[model samples]
Target: AAAVAGMRDNNAILSSRDWARRDVLMQTKCAPLPREEGRPAPRPLNLVQAATVASHAWPPQSTCETLGLTALCDTVRSVAVNREVIAAVSNKNIFHMLQLYVNGIKAAGIKNSMVVALDDETAAWLKVRDVANYVKVLRSRTGDTGNHATSGLKFKVLIDFLSVGCSV
Candidate 1:
């Protein structure tokens, strides 16, 4: 497909030897600042510290809350065609959103599609673009909005859709 070819071409350019050398040169020129007088020197984590951190649970068992189950059911029902809903899960990455809108959704002429925004910014972006009807903002119960935490909330959204009698 044309998209696949374009992606391959972009990857080839990014992984070229010249780009690698330039990346290394930029990193060397932008090295971190020296330690301040009273501040401890920066160092990699010790084995014990690394192990302790790694052993802890990540993204903290969180739940997602939307406007309400009734609202979700309404949105799903409005977008569904024969009980099938097309859903796209996204965070605040606008570039990817544009690509999906243009190449995937728009190109396919999909009317049964909706976007599940994992954060407030993404929800606002979708609304501003006149896609508010297709956007659902899923907020984390634990109040963590980091990328990993938001990603972990996607399963809950999918389950919600299925519970509303719509297949995504």
Candidate 2:
């Protein structure tokens, strides 16, 4: 196949591991490093750098605050979150980074319920909702072309179901 041959031709420029590491939040050389003093190493930081830091901090919420993210997590009639949302993300391994989104939040009892869990930061992010209340599940980048937007798919309810599955 041309695609396979092209990949072989460009092997010198590509690392097979790159395909696996793409989704990872890699630390930059300028970022903090471990120190013998039992503290994080001093490193350059900026706004974008701060965002990168926040997502991996001990508690994700603190990271969001560190970056001064304007997304307010609050109660609304409905909210949308990318499936990657997590309340307390943990990296067990390269492939085991837990996505904290609403489901994990509920599982952790961080909030009484997902619908009511949106706080000041997450609320501000609702504008870019992925599913926007569920009528139609967010379509895959490659899926059916029905283009039919169904009605009445509740995200909170679905999140609850997902939570239930995890408990089992």
Candidate 3:
């Protein structure tokens, strides 16, 4: 009851229609506007200005490149299945677990599985093995050492996949 009272005081409650209208307004306000012909590119926003921007700009442009989201989307499209199976692996476990994992998926006749390689070496290894078709190398900001290090990255990976319209 106290929580509900607090939320009401904060104006946090709204009807579904009100929430839908708010969403439309936010999308309209935050969307990048088209530049008029011959107009100079807008100056880059300073730190303060950027910080003030809406959260809707999320999965920022740099994140897309760093995660190789476009490539992942392409790989997902190549699979005919409605859902995709993703295996996130770093070079540390490539030899120890990748083959066994891939074999299991193959034995099950799953055609939509793909690997999200956490390092360049893993990507290279996949290419050399001629099984790089469904692999997408995700560039990590900090070097990922093992499963523990990469575990925290799952949410970000899932967000990027969602942004690209892929279902895992």
Candidate 4:
């Protein structure tokens, strides 16, 4: 009850529609007006300011380039199942996107038998397979008695210290 009263006191309970309308109005003011033909073109606005030029049609190519996706896309495309990371992405046309990823992976020389295809799950898992090899290396390092001062350190103070540091 007190929280509700405080919100009313501060006029903090604005509707999303009202907020969106206000944002659009603010952006419209920042846009440049038409000028005479003889004048030099206006200087480019910074990326944030450029967004105001077309509030309804923002998130343009420049925005994606600004975020370093141009370089990232090439590398991530080899491993990424879809346009984005598998765990955090969704698609309106999931079937089409999945087909694209599968085709891309297949074209990259991955065997069809190696790729897993399920109704709700599909992945090449090449990188994931490499990661499993890394896990094997890590396990070997921990068990390598030749390098360690003692044969077993599970009960040692150094192991406790390492575990504590890891938790932090």
TM-score of each: 0.48, 0.18, 0.50, 0.16
Between candidates 2 and 3, which one is better according to lDDT? 3
Model 1, runs deviating above 4 Å:
1-67, 98-103, 132-148
lDDT tens per residue, model 1, 1-168: 122212333235453444433443344443333444687766643331122322222111121133246656556556665556677677775546455673556444566777777667777777776552335566677877666777777788876765444567
Runs of candidate 4 exceeding 4 Å displacement: 5-47, 70-168
Q: Which tens-of-lDDT digit does each residue in 1-168 have in candidate 3?
A: 222212333235676665433333344443334555687998743332133433444325455576667566555556524334455444546466877776655555556667766666677776666453444345445765666666766666676576644456
Q: Given candidate 3, what's the lDDT at residue 46? A: 32
**Pick by TM-score: 2 or 4, better one:** 2
Output the worst ten-in-a-row residue range by lDDT, candidate 4: 131-140
Candidate number with greatest lDDT: 1
In order, candidate lDDTs are: 0.55, 0.28, 0.54, 0.30
Ranking by TM-score: 3, 1, 2, 4
Let me know the TM-score candidate 2 reaches against the reference structure.
Answer: 0.18
Worst 10 residues of 3 by lDDT: 1-10
Candidate 2 lDDT, tens digit per residue, 93-126?
2112122454334343332222211223323333
**Candidate number of the best TM-score:** 3
Task: List ranges where model 3 is wrong by over 4 Å.
Answer: 1-68, 132-144
Residue 17, model 2: Cα distance from true site in angstroms: 28
For each of the candidates, give the backbone clash count.
Answer: 0, 18, 0, 0
